[model samples]
Target: MVVARTRTTCVLGALLGGALLVSGCGDDSSDDAFSGQKADDIAAKAVAATDKASSVHMKGTAKVKGASTVGLDIRVDDQGNCTGTISGDGARAQLLRSKGGDVLIKGDRAFWTNSARAGGGDAKQGEQLAGKLAGKWVTAPADGPDAAFCDKKRFLASMDQDKTERQGMKRGTETEVDGEDALTLEKEQEGNRISMHVATEGEPYILKAATAGSEDSTMTFDDYGEKVKVQPPSQDEIVDPADTQA
Candidate 1:
């Protein structure tokens, strides 16, 4: 069963910053131009790249701390929904991808809603693991075509309006993410500093998000030219729909 084998063998179609400020006042126009490109523009590129990876099929492996600890094979469709199965220890559970932006896990019998209210309902062992995978969706670039970057766009827009460099600047470094070379973006703003490793893997862009302040999140994309696939989930093992919430 895929669910029982928890030593990290959940194979098959599986998945998948910073800054500070000080002193009184300052403004280096050159520095601002170099680094402070409108968050909208930069985010647009990211979102555009992401929007291109929609309605595609992909297979990979994933792992999350304090979570289910299994490998997965997941899939997503053009409508922005996902589904799949996870395997570990010969135990397998069905994973459902919802159009409403949440996941329902079978076998362990748990469901998670994409509520921004901080805490949802009961967290299952599998759900906890899935949380590590699903939670990253919230970080999608705002100002994109889908309005998916709702939270991020709002935050950056707020900063832009205040003219407050709450997020600090970065002298980025060239680094590798998910085996692809990318420019690691770093920033410290509004009491939150985060470093995001951006890269491309075929159609879906990969955004590995990590914060100096809290938990880390990862998002994979599958670009279909017009629409993009964001935060895709499992593909292979299909948990019984009846076992999940409707």
Candidate 2:
């Protein structure tokens, strides 16, 4: 949220930050034999844990070819509900979908069409259409070509199954993220890399997955199991494509 003129500071993803520290205790997992686990086992376990969580808070930066870079902030619920904003290059868009698959898009005109069109990727085309779509809401189809980005739960839940894209995964380091005990696992293929920050102290959740120099973009995960409720915009605000003045 950006603060308008008056005098106030907006907040974005504020959280308690601290590394998970291991104290002297019976399990003393700091020295546990996790080192003996196979790379495949670790990778598989991380994937399994992430899938099981079925929900999370995600935020990150992703490079968009014609759009420069975009910042993504999203929350996904177990029932496949997702809500978030993707903003960059002076443009921003709000997106949401219910568990039933109805999609709603609000904000930047360029963003709405780019996401709602099956063949929409022309940068020039987006701007032109955006001019005509001011103050309009797009009710997109569930299976639209661009719906993938709007449906985080469905996309990420199957990340572990991308065996062909992930390779040579090896443990990197034992650390903490957002105050949780975490272990790093990394894999690279064809110059694309995915580094997973897997929680080690509890249920082995994939706390975060960061990708740099990849077509997939960089993203982070947190606040697993947090409730994320989305309310649809009011009816009159929606702009039917057929009824548009443009």
Candidate 3:
């Protein structure tokens, strides 16, 4: 859950900003299916479709408040299974969440060292913890703080509509996202420009959301309804925190 707050602000804010803007017509209109539709309507449809998705793969880069850019590549399902990699602050880790709510993380040396120091350990202790935990799958209980990153429910809830943010919105020129036909929606708020691309040929799911100015961010969504497959790490690869003195 390292980038959880940042992800919510960057990704969910893009979604809400795009959805909240007042509807307007675009400059050019072709015979595309969504050309005649209202921007708000299209945005609403996209939001609804995304809300109903059984699963999705999200990839993006966002700046954390006290950290440099963070990168995410996560595939998660409604059943709470997820697998992904998170990289930030010169550290990277692979994470897996089982359907039964278990979370396992295998991080590089830098990641372990950073975590150790962040938890108030001294340099020597950080290095020792890294030596023992680096590249080892560490199990986290379902109710633990680490499990917050694996909660698909919280992820989606961040995108829920916020009426107060609604302002002026307009449709942009039709575009393509990841080889799929999409309609662009644009909005601006507090010096930030927000854009959302919604698929036009299918279920109108939001394919991408981007924000620029002050803080730049981008999140893309795909693999709708795909199954999230994950398995717990073997005992040999797992490092229980209770067993570690660090």
User: What lDDT score belongs to each candidate, Candidate 1 first?
Assistant: 0.35, 0.55, 0.67
CA error at residue 217 for candidate 1, angstroms: 4.0
Q: Give the worst 10-residue stretch by lDDT in candidate 2.
A: 1-10
Tell me how many residue pairs clash in candidate 3.
Answer: 3
> Which run of 10 residues does model 3 get worst, by summed lDDT?
11-20
Instruction: Give the residue spans of candidate 3 off by over 4 A.
Output: 1-37, 159-166
48-134, model 3: which lDDT tens digit per residue? 687788898888877545556767788988887999987777788887988756678788888877776666668888789889888
Model 1 lDDT vs. the true structure?
0.35
| Per-residue lDDT of 122 in model 1 | 40
- Pick the lDDT winner: 3
Name the candidate that leads on TM-score: 3
Q: What would the per-residue lDDT of candidate 2 be over residues 123-149, giving only the tens digit for each residue?
A: 665566667664566666666633444
Candidates, ranked, lDDT: 3, 2, 1
Candidate 1 structure quality by residue, lDDT tens digits, 1-246 = 001111211111121111111101122232322255433334334434543444433333333344433334455554545555554433454444455344444432222222211133344534554444342222121123222112222212322232232234343565676466554456654344455444523432434444343323232332333333344445543333233333
lDDT: the better of candidates 1 and 2: 2
Which 10-residue window in model 1 sums to the lowest lDDT? 15-24
